[model samples]
Target: MFEGLKVVVGLISFILVYRTVTGNCNKYLAFAICAIWLRFFLAAFHTITYPPLIVGFSINALGSISVACLGLLVIPTPVFTLKKFFPFFLFFVCIAISGFVNMKIPGTINVLVKWCYFLVLASALILSVRVQGQNATFKKLLVAFTMPVALQILSVVLGQAKATEADGSASYIGGYNHEAAFSMIIVSFIFVVGLIERGTLSFRTSLFTLSVFLLVLVNYRTSILTILPIAAVFYFTLAEQRLKPSQKAPVMMIVAMVLLSSFLALSFTMKERFADIGLLLSNLDLMLKAPIYFSDAERDIMSARVYIWSQYIDAFRNADLLNQLLGFGPDSWKGRFNLYAHNTFVSYIYEYGVLGVGSFVFVCISVLLNALTLKDRKLSKILALSFVGFLAMNMATMPLWNIEGLIFFAILNAVLIGHKKSSKSRQVSTDNRELLNAN
Candidate 1:
């Protein structure tokens, strides 16, 4: 069957990617590149589920294993301090306990295994870069991060160029699947901000701009709303720093021209969808009040998200003490609600419980604090801003456990936190050297 073939192909891909990572190549870069491909491309190929034994087998699972292995191979020692490791440990333990007590054995094991994989992989990535040195590691990571966006643009162009049906009706899935457009937009936004912070915008401006245009065309409204403001702020800030007064106007004009062209193109290609935006705006108040004031039919017009959220609230309120304190288990919401919570915080509370959710919040706070410590660094500030944006996006979207979101979050946090530690160490070394010289 095709399911078996998918598993076979995934294994082969994992092997090749693992070998590439372990080889003389830049291991961190190789892992980053492979992670992106596995998350966006290979994982999209198939989903194989046999239930209870192995719930889901996909390229993402294989990719996580390979990256974890690479991390273990490169660092051969514990790289995380207790402060950095405890929250995740507590969170994982809570999930395990919650699942076991709930008798959701299969889901508990699945959740634990996946979290273990993510933990090892994230830790390895941070330590691997530490061992490799920041300058070299950052350069490789930048290329690895940008490569997918570049390939995504190429895929979109090729897809657009392909001949359509005899009736001349074209399907506009473009580069990635339509379902994944929101995730692509988030990654692309991060890429643009990261490159700008690194001072490589001039070299990559056209490609990044094209990627952004395609992402907008894909038309995930929440993603557009979340990313655009952040992108604009970061872009203008970078422009101010990098452009001379004499050059700023021309650069700004070029940006405006490109944006206007993209808007016109979208308007022509997707007139109805654009009109729908206006319609939605007109009915915004009704949409907002639909859950309480309007009829069921009107609530359905809002795509049922508000209704679903209401159901989640009801479920939480009626949960047993154990479920309320710890949560049912990972993926356990489906058994009761027949769907995902569709909100990360809701999912966390429903699946991982209050303890797990609190641990996650603490981890996020720690990352923000670390970012703030590097206040003078523009990249750190931009990264902190991006993290906040990502967290906000999670409010309306359940991206916490998904492969693309996990990989993006892990890589960004690892790189930023690792850099912070390295900077501190360097400063301490310099101070010691100065003391010695003075003595």
Candidate 2:
């Protein structure tokens, strides 16, 4: 029964991607959005792979290709700017150099190819959004992105799907094969919250409520922590402008009650898993003083991540100059530690080196600053807040390399940057009109 459902869902997903790509007015943008959602289904089906060369073909590669092809076909005269392409260029060069130096032919080829695909996808998204309009494209992309997540939620509720183990223990999976599901939910929530703030979507929607429930089920502590402050800020912001004084008190009381009840319910249902967090917190002092290299017993208590991070730091310190500046190539960490760095920043540094990491950071900061300077201050604030949430989540897990999470990251950032560019163009046009009228 489960297998049949998976096949049905996968078929529908492919049809949707095909229809959106070929049928939409803005085919390039639609193709990109469709490809992003396609990752969700692909991951679920476990069909995305590159065989003996790279094992699993990433959603990044699939989505990138989809959008890149659309751009080539429809926008034969597509524009490219150094401001947009330079950072990616530097980062890819670093990876290629590192890969060649390391002599990991398969890994090197894989990294180079994936990075190129990502660059193409990013470029296509920005160009498509520029030719179209940001507001319309964003709304369409949001709807398309939400569909697979809704399906996933349904599958889990229907008992057609089960979580995969994160550690040796099964508790961390939270009913999905990868932790990226948790990140996806968080990103989706950010989008929903932005919509609510804009008055485009109602806060009381069933989908939003169900999403909140799924988030709690996922049991990602960092995401939970990030959501609290965002929720509070969102509520306070909205209440001041949108709510009556009488309505504010009751709304706050209701929210508090709901949160408290949810916490109590999770505490009882996930006692053992929650206890692991409590134990980790209780042993914080011991953890700091413990040896850099932990024993199996020590690792079990510390969740093995501390020891892994320590190993990564030591390896980086001990690497040769060229490797230190460029990195030891993609997936090189797996050779030494048998696992990827759980942290995104650490992973980037390990795989792409100081120069690559620097370029990536510069691009992020540039987009953020551009977002902040937007005339639509509300959306700008939401974008800025969402980026902060993304960064906070990245500190705990490496989502940039994960297919589903990378789709969310790439799409969200691309939309924001495209919107910023569009806004500037409008400002320039308005200024030109004013000058002509004065003349």
Candidate 3:
């Protein structure tokens, strides 16, 4: 069953990349879709199935770098739009400098390459919208996400769910190496379908989100923190505004069905997971109510995320002025403490410095502002609200450290900013024509 599922992902990737290289499909769409599979599914699957190393590097590194190169080749010319893209450019510049100054040469180079890959990915998404228009591009994204959804369902059906080391817990990994990674993928899919294609409620999207939420419950519990508030905003959108009264009823019914079904499925399908679920509830108390300090108990909270964060902060606080400004270096945490800080701000602040973390936050703020300004109100609100969940994720886990997480917000921000830019261009053109007629 595992081999069969791997075959499915392989075939899907081959078909998409072939269509793209052959000019049978949009290069941006095909490449973006295939990159997700390559980055999220294939690399890990390839490793365990065979010798993952060529020379010294793992297949994961090789495959991701190869895909990054392809993205650069297929991407449009880089856009330096201040709010849309420049913040990322500025942010990566900080990363590069910190990497160089701190002498983390090899790791910094690898990190910068990934940063470049992400920039290319964002550019490709924006170009797709500008050329193909929003509706066409978003429809493809909606279709693209179904592969993950299918894999999730199949994992459950075939009983191929992987177990995490903690308490030998069964994680609904859905063909990915880690359930956390799978949860991140589902979060991206939610933004793709639920927020990106707002107001265009369809059977495909409704069913997709239902499975997505259900699978999320059975996977990494951190995503439950991310998805719940977004789900609330989603429900409110369905009921309070966006759709007309006539259109609201069925969507509301769908929302109710989705939530109820997801919980019921969780209860029946994952009885053993209840212990983990109980931990999730308990952790929520630590996460929300417990104040993070230098205490040992606080350090132990949320899988010791707070502890690591406090340590990272303490280290950063004690560092010299140069190190404080620039950071000890990219990925320096592993060298300094033998573990990742596990929180985005904590990790980046220590490794990339205050300046680096500031730019990173700027990129996020830019996404929120861009999403808020989008022409689609439902898309705007849901996406903006989803940012709360995103920020929450960053506080507890290092979601930004992964390609899927970066690409998720990248695609979203691209769509938001690109659509706005395209609309503005058209309006300006129309205005010019009207002026000429008046003259």
Candidate 3 per-residue lDDT, tens place, 1-439, comes to 6767667765775565465445634667666666765665553474463354776557777776787787766664434343457788889899999999988987797788777667767766666666566666666665455556667767777887777745576777666666666677788876665644445646644754575555464567567667766776665565555668788778878877877786667566555544444555565544333234446655555566655656778788779999899898888877568678778887888988989989988988887887778776766777777787888878767777777677776676666655653454556434223322332
Off by over 4 Å in 2: 13-24, 47-79, 82-85, 161-176, 181-205, 220-241, 244-292, 295-297, 420-439
What is candidate 1's lDDT per residue for 198-293, written digit by digit as tens? 444444555455556655644554454455544655555657677889998989877767656755775677564345445545765542242356
Local distance difference test, each candidate: 0.57, 0.58, 0.67
Lowest summed lDDT across 10 adjacent residues in model 1 is found at 46-55
Every model's TM-score: 0.72, 0.75, 0.80
Q: Write the per-residue lDDT of candidate 2 for residues 1-439, one digit (tens) a residue.
A: 6546656766776666566567654755765666566555554544433222234545545544555455455433323343544555666676677777777677876666555445555555665556555655555555554445555566556644344335433223222355555446445545544444345554434544555555654556556544554454454456556668778778877767766776678677756555655665676554334346566666665346555655676677677887778877778887578777667777777776787677778767776776677677766776677677777767656666655565556555565645543454556333223322322
Task: Sort every candidate by lDDT, greatest first.
Answer: 3, 2, 1
Report the number of the highest-lDDT candidate.
Answer: 3
Candidate 1 vs. true structure, TM-score: 0.72
As for lDDT, the candidate ahead, 2 or 3, is: 3
* Poorly placed runs, candidate 1 (over 4 Å): 1-26, 47-75, 131-135, 142-151, 158-178, 181-189, 192-202, 243-294, 421-439
Question: Candidate 3, which segments miss by more than 4 Å at Cα?
Answer: 16-24, 44-55, 78-83, 165-169, 196-202, 239-299, 421-425, 428-439
